[model samples]
Target chain A: MEEWTVKVEQSDNKKEKPDTEQLEFGRSFTDHMFVMDYSEPVGWHDARIVPYQPLTIEPSAMAFHYGQSVFEGMKAYHAQNGDIQLFRPDKNLARLNHSNDRLCIPPIDEEFVLKAIKQLVYMDKEWIPKAEGTSLYIRPFIISTEPYLGVAPSHHYKLIVILSPVGAYYKEGINPVKIAVENHYVRAVKGGTGEAKTGGNYASSLKAQEVVGKQGYSQVLWLDGVEKKYIEEVGSMNVFFKINGEVVTPALNGSILSGITRDSVIEMLKYWDIPVSERRISMEELYQAYLDGQLEEAFGTGTAAVISPIGELAWEGKKIHVNEGEIGNVAKRLYDTMSGIQYGKVEDPFGWIVKVKEAAPVK
Target chain B: MEEWTVKVEQSDNKKEKPDTEQLEFGRSFTDHMFVMDYSEPVGWHDARIVPYQPLTIEPSAMAFHYGQSVFEGMKAYHAQNGDIQLFRPDKNLARLNHSNDRLCIPPIDEEFVLKAIKQLVYMDKEWIPKAEGTSLYIRPFIISTEPYLGVAPSHHYKLIVILSPVGAYYKEGINPVKIAVENHYVRAVKGGTGEAKTGGNYASSLKAQEVVGKQGYSQVLWLDGVEKKYIEEVGSMNVFFKINGEVVTPALNGSILSGITRDSVIEMLKYWDIPVSERRISMEELYQAYLDGQLEEAFGTGTAAVISPIGELAWEGKKIHVNEGEIGNVAKRLYDTMSGIQYGKVEDPFGWIVKVKEAAPVK
Candidate 1:
């Protein structure tokens, strides 16, 4: 691990913190943000914390035209006793590098960048909402900044980390969401950018989301791009199904995103002696299981919601109800345990929590 | 068509023009650019031609995070008698709207935007290169500019058009280049954003291009994402093959871009009474044609290259040479005729040329 010196510049005019109860996802930002530049020779340099403001970019910047960009999503929780904590931050940074490789962007020093993120979060500690189900969402993204219009990898890049205080994903407790099984559109396929947390994958998914959203579905459950039969994901989250007393998830084919919360849930299930399997689970098999009354529960896992319960699935004009349109016991327990460990209320047996220290006093 | 007002603001400090012969593709931009803003209720508004400069965008803009952006590439040629002409600019604008629909961006009025482009090009008439094969490259792009970070369609957007003086794609005569058939990576699937000229498709292609480039190939021929057997595109251009005196190209499947130059080539072939077909083309079928000595020629068509002849193809540990690694007769004739019509040296039979008049005297 390299010890990189990150320069700090406090903002002269700090923003008034937003009301925690009214906080929206990615709407309000903190006063300061961590910034870094990357170019050839000087791989990644000029690390500094400056005021969160608009970026002056050329209209021909490669990210705007070529979509050579990558991002990560995580959060900072205002834990008990005034401590600030991060859940599986290292995993998120590791996934960021994986996404960079897929997008052909240069890699970052994850450990050093994690330190900078902690510092930025600490600098804006007041922005971390302490209300229940509220925390500061951390978005670390990299964009190709070169002004040339050529269709090639950019030499210049910008890595930025911004903090946004967000309210709970579910305002009225952990409720289930209706998901439409996508048939006409695809999110990603094997050998595509689906496994990476890049902008294009999300961009490609908007149409399907919009279409299903208009049909009164809260989100969409994406099937495999090839067969369009096997389950892949549900609204940018890794999906799991409890069938016949066993939990099964769509194995990470090349196109499925490797989710951190998905990893945590599997580990937690293993620790609790719950039967879990990651394999190719086809829609036909799931439907057969439903017909046999073996379908027990369904849920999605991600950093935002931690665990999202799927109540109903509409596939090819047929609706399939899961767990009688209620949150399953496993989902409720997983969410409680995950949120408990995240907010420092439960024992972190896996050592996934990283703490941010308060600023040291000047000598 | 509704007539709209376009405001103009000339730059106080105009940049010195670069040497025509020393120009590179998309490196040197013109002095001015056209821009328009789109928002809900207001729709597409504030069309203006302003000085070419950097854009001040929020760090959290949706374009940077989700890659909801689309762009079109065409050119303005400096004709033989100092007239500036555009080749099938209407096709490019129509395709731009198609891309907008796929990316969930607001659509632009093609007629209004084309008029704005002509006005901007007329304003920067001196920047159009006069060298033999050089011209002004026009890039019209739309980006989601909302500062919010939700994974949905953006309500705010920016439509911008910039001009860059580009040299000839081939410094010497139009020569053939080696291409590698990409096997491991996929560009797009049938239900994906492949047909749309969005950033994600290009971003997904960089890795395959980089891998093949290291193997001494200039470009990679993309296969269908689902089966990886059918040919989709070559580099960023639409590919065509002449087999047994008939030209065949991949049909407009949902996963292949609909190129304007490609359309021109098909129409020109039809006009010449040469056999041409747009259908699903498999690499195996092409290989069989080569084996039977029936493969006549292969070429790619796009705005940048106009016509790129394929000399050799390396696929699955086998190398197949086309036309003895030389430029084919049809490719040469197409390039000559296309460039001739674009530069105003030949007859325009298909009504493809749209001339930009000289700016009227300000009275």
Candidate 2:
């Protein structure tokens, strides 16, 4: 793999880090960021870590007008032994490339990017809060920088990575959330951008999400865009259901995002010899299971919340309180185990963690 | 409606206007651009026309990360009699607000926005090319400026309008082009952001477009996301067909943009007492019409390419030559009438043209 040359420029005045206990998601940022530029003929070049600051882009840049942008969400954790680690960093980079392919953006060398990310994370190691459930949130994104307005793939692009100190997703840890079954708005469809980690998928979900939020729901449980029957995803996270001690999740239908956490959960369930199946679970079938008292637990998995337990599902004004509006046993166990491995407190049977290291000796 | 307070800062250095004959679309901007900002509590304010330059946005701005951006495309014509005019500016603003609503961005007052656009266009009237089939392209866009990574409605937004000198959309005059029916990629679904003029819809079409471009097609004719049978809009324009002496275009099924030019064409057809139907026309049905020798003409409508005559369609490796690969009478007539009215060469039967007035004598 071609290595990206790392050039570091430290910030003269670093902002004081926020209180870890009061840290909100994506609000406060670290002192520096990483960026790489791509143009036709020459692929990604000039990879460097510089002071985190506003970027100047032409108003006619393709990213602003065409939405040719993709991003990945992951975190860097301060492990128990003073070692900074990343949970499935390779997976995140792979997914980012998946989105880049779908968006027609140029791909980056995974190994080189991994090294850059590790070096950047190490440079801002102090930003990783030591508090429980707190970590330095890493956002690696690419936007088309070409200033042409025609609706074609851009000839120039910029890949950027910024770090933010984020607290726990939920202030009250492990609490359940209410999700409204989305029927009026569709997030994505087969042969659509649903599977890619692109900004359009998230932009398309804002309306339904806003409506559900106004209706006193925390998130919208999206169904298949075609049939509007089978479950797809929960907001930005992949969903799973434990019905009568058997776990079932909506299979990867090319319209659902392939989440890293979802894959980990499936692997962990199989490792534990738990009955887990990856197949289509229709909303009607799930409701029937709930009526039969077979539905045990439901949760969403992502890098942000890790595991967001679905307490209540509102469908057509009919509500079903999952596990009597409490966090299910499977949800708690999965969260504990996943996060435990992430924070380096538990055994890593799958070897998902990657320790951060200095890319080169400091000058 | 609140009137926007226009503050003007003239550019110290103005770029030389490109030759009208060789002017490319959206590549060269005029001297000044308009901008407005919006916050949660304080709505849109400080409307100003400043020098056209790059905009600096935070790396974590929601628009860059999650694609919370919407835009509208229109044009300002340089009339023969030293006058500049906009065709249906109100319609564009109304549609812009519609996109804003769908994307969860705060809505703008249509009347006020139209006024702002008129003032900006009037200030940059010298950029409007006077040569045949050339004009100043007006791009009005809104982007989420809130520096956060969460996927929801943004608390801050920026509304901007920029002008670019553009020549004819088709360099070879009003010639016909071929289209490939897209089945591998779907642009929009029933409950998706298809109807809105958002960036995501355009972004999602780039990959398919790139493939078809290599296949020697000018555009991709998208089908419905669910069945992939019924015709949707072209990625850039809305489509229309003449079958059995009647004009038919896809109905506003929430998955196709309600194009202003498409609306104008419908109204023009109605005014001429021509049979025009807004209904679903399946690809199979269109192919059957072609087989029966009843399919007379096919064309696309949009502001950029006012009328794009589709000369041929390639479906499943079978090609159907349309109108003997020539511009049909209906398409020629529509393009002539639309551009004629736009350039002040024909009578404006409807009050669609908004003549630009000088903006309070620039200081």
Candidate 3:
């Protein structure tokens, strides 16, 4: 692997950190950020860590007009033992490449970018919240920066990594939320950019999310675009249902995002000797299971909310309560174990955590 | 209707005009642009015509991350008698609002934005190329500018209008191009953002275009995302077929883009007393018509290439030639009439031309 050097320019004036208790998701950011440029001749070069600020880009930049952008979400935990750690950073970087392939973007050296991210997080170590369930959310994204209006892949690109300290998803506890099954709007189709963490997939989903959000639904459960029958995803997360003591999730189809947290949950379940199968499970089957009282649990997995339990599903003007509209044992255990492992309070049986070395304070 | 005011800022230094014959599509921008801001309390405000330049936007802007952006494409022609005219500008603006609806973007006043565009185009009137088939391409786009990462609609937005001097899509005469039927890599599903002139739909199409481009095909004929049977679009344009004397196009099924040029063609056909209909036309049906020697012509209609004739189609290892692999009479006549009306050489019976009053040169 080629060794990549990232030049650091520390900001002289540091902004005051936000109160950990009042930290909002993606609202506040650290003082510094990592950036890299990609062009035709230079594949990916000019890596630097500079003061977080606005980007001077052309109004006709392809990313703004064509939506040729992809992003990944992860977190840095301020461990109980004063060590900063990353949960499955490698997995996130690998998935970034997968998204790049699907979005027609040039790939980056995963190991080098990971090193740059670790260095950026270390320099902003003080910004990491120490409160319970508080962590620094890391968002790594790529945008096509070519100042052209033609509809094609961009020649120039910008890869950016920014950090934000966020409070726990559920301030009270591991509570379940209601989800509305979407029938009119579709998130993705099999041959589309659904599996890729591209901007368009998320953009296409905002309308449906907005519509359901008005009806007191926390999120939307998307069905397959082709059939509108087979289950696809719940909001932006991978969804799973525990029916008759067996866990089932939609397979890693082309239209479904291959979520890191979803993979971790599957691994953990396998470790616990829980029977889990990945296949095409239709909404009709799930509804039948609910009718038969075999639907024990339903949950979603993602980086932000590790395990979001679905308490109620409203489909076609009918509502069905899962596990009496409460978090099931499987969901509770998964959330606790995932958060525990992330915060270094549990044994690292899977070696998923990558410890960050302390860096000298920026002057 | 409330009349909107537009503030103007001229550029201190004027850029040298590109050679009319050497002008490229969307590569060289005009001297000035129109911009407007949208926020919660202030709807769409700060409407201004400013010097064309780069935008200093936050790296975490919602448009770059979520693709919540929509745009419109039209042209300002340097007419035969020295008048600048826009063809169906109102239709383009109306469609822009329709796209805004699907992408969850706040709507802009069509009349106000159209007035702003005319003024901006007049201010930079000298940039419009006088060469045959050349014109100033006007791009009006709205981007989500809120600096947040959470998945939702943006609270802040910037609607911008930029102009570029584009050479003729066909440097030579209106010639036909070969197209490949895409069996994989769906463009947009019926329930997806296919109908919206948004960034994601274009972004999702690059891979398919690239693959077909490598095989010496000009564009890909996209099938319906649900069935992959019915024709949806040809490249980014709405497609049409001439079968045994009748012109047929896919109906405005939620997934197919409602193109202004497509509308114009249908109108032109009706005015010329030719049979025209909007209905779902499957690839198999087209092939059967070709087998029966009834498929006379195939063409695509859009703002870029007002009429793009498809000479041949390659599908599943089989190839079919249309009109003996030549441009058909219907496509030729439509192109001539449309471009003629646009350039003010032909009579505008439909009152589609909006003439721009001359503005004082930038001082």
Candidate 4:
């Protein structure tokens, strides 16, 4: 494995850290960040951890003009004993490479990149807030840096990792939110880049999101692009529903992101011997289930929120309240168990958590 | 209209202009450029023409991570009488607003932006190459400048216009080329950003482009995203077919970009009293037409090449030669007439040409 050079910031900015109680998602940054570059034939080189600063990229870089970029989001939890732990970061790096494959970007050594992420997190370990539900959000992304304006994959790329101290996703703590079922705008189709965590998918979703937000909904529930019948995903999260004691989610049908948290929820349910399934569930069936009082719960899972319970779903001018517009037992259990393992409070039988080692102070 | 501030470069770089014969598209830039800013409430402000320089954007800018960017392509022509002109630049600005609407970006005043474009183009008129079939390509793009990583429309944006003196799109003049019909990857779908001239749509096409490029094809003919059966577009251009005696191009479905060049071709065909139809045409129907010897010509139209004749098509291992692997009479006439009007060699009776006036030196 190649070693990553560490250049600690000469003027540390940790003293300007915001009060953890009022932190928002992805707003503030840590003192240091990790960066690497890749060029043709040279492979990925210049791996280093440097001070957090604005990047000087060419105006005509492919990333700005062609949208040739992908990013991964994960978090580092601060345990009660001051240990920093990451939940399933290996899966995130693996998914990043998977996204790169679909986007025609060069793949990085997953193990080596993960090590670099850990080192960067360790260097800025003090930024990990000790408050409950607070963690250091890590965003790792690759952007095309080639200073040309053509509709092709860039010849040069830069991989950057930045750390942000984020507070709890729900200010009031895990309250159920309403969502609007989007019928006009489509997110991804079978042959599209939906399965890949690329920027285009999210960029295409802003219109629907804005419309739904204006209607007082917290998120938009995206349907399959082809028929617009089958459920695809919710916002940027993988969705799940508890119908008649069975937990189900839309299958990874090449149009939904293979979320790590979604996978963990399935695993946790299966471990507890609860009935679980991965298959296509249409909105009609879900509404019917709700009408019959069999729709127990509906929620979204992602790294940022961990669990976002869906209270009411507005579909075609009709509303279906899930679990009495309140958090369901299944969602609460999953969120607690998942976050428990992440915070080192619960026993991790799946070998998911990777602890970070503290780094020595720089000269 | 408000007059834009002009900030000419103190150090002239006219001596560094590349030889027009060896010029590559979008590689070398001109001496000056145009810029404008958009923010909440203030709308678009600070319109100015400034020297071409690298932009200093934050690494966490929403444009870099979420692909909140849109761009337009047009060209400035040097007339035989030393007059500089633009061909239907109003149409480009109109299309730019259309794209901005789809991406949830704030729209600019079309007439005002057009004035800015003309002022900037006239200031750098020396960069308009005098070589045959050569013109100065103008790229006006808007990028989100908000320093955040959320998946939402940005409140702050910057519109930048850069000029590049480009040679003929085809190195050896316009010639018919071979294309492969892509069956796997999709470009865009109904209710997607395909209709917008945005970066994401172009970014998603690079993978398929790379694959076909390896198969010795110049471009990949894109199929509809949902069914992957009906023809959508070829590369970045709108496609056309001359069957028997009539000209036909795909109708502007939601998933197809309404290309300015494509519209011009249709207008020209109608002006010449040629039978033209804008409707959906499937590849199967095209193949059937080829089998019956009714497919007389095939070509693609866009700003970059204006007209790209398709001499050969390889689909599912079957190769069909278009017009005996030669440019058809219609394709030749269209290319000649288009270039003729652009170069001021033909009378533009359609009132499509807009002349540019010389700009005074900056104070």
DockQ of each: 0.88, 0.88, 0.86, 0.75
For model 1, residues B1-363, the per-residue Cα lDDT tens digits are 123788889999899999877898887898999998998978998888899999999999999999999999999999998889999999999999999998888788898888889999899998988989999999999999999988889999999999999998889977799999999999999889999999998899999999999989999999998889999999999999999999999999899999999999999999999999999999999999999999999999999999999999999998889999898888898999999999999999999999998644211
Chain B TM-score of every predicted model:
0.98, 0.97, 0.97, 0.96
Residue A46 lDDT, candidate 3, scale 0-100 = 83
* 2 or 4, greater by DockQ: 2
Query: Mind giving the per-residue lDDT tens digits that candidate 2 earns over B38-147?
Result: 99687988788999999999999999989999999999998878789899989989999999999989888787777778888887888888888889999999999999
Cα distance off (Å), candidate 2, residue B266: 0.3
lDDT of 3 by residue, B206-264 (tens): 99999999999999999999889999999999999999999999999999899999999
| Cα lDDT, model 3, residue B304 | 93
User: What do the candidate models score in CA lDDT, each in turn?
Assistant: 0.92, 0.91, 0.92, 0.88
Candidate 2 residues A1-363, lDDT tens each? Answer: 144478889999999999888898999899999999999787888888999999999999999999999999999999989889899999999999999999999898887888888888998998999988889999999999999998889999999999999997766767899999999999999988999999888988998988989989999999999999999999899999999999999999999999999999999999999999999989999999999999999999999999999999999878978998899988899999999998899989898999997657322
Residue B307 displacement (Å), model 4? 0.6
Q: Which 10 consecutive residues of model 4 chain B have the lowest summed lDDT?
A: B1-10
Q: lDDT, candidate 3, residue A177?
A: 93
Per-residue error (Å), model 4, residue A361? 11
TM-score of every model? 0.98, 0.98, 0.98, 0.97
List residue ranges in candidate 2 displaced over 4 A.
A1-3, A359-363, B1-3, B359-363
Off by over 4 Å in 1: A1-3, A359-363, B1-3, B359-363
**Positional deviation of residue B227's Cα in model 3 after best superposition, in angstroms:** 1.2
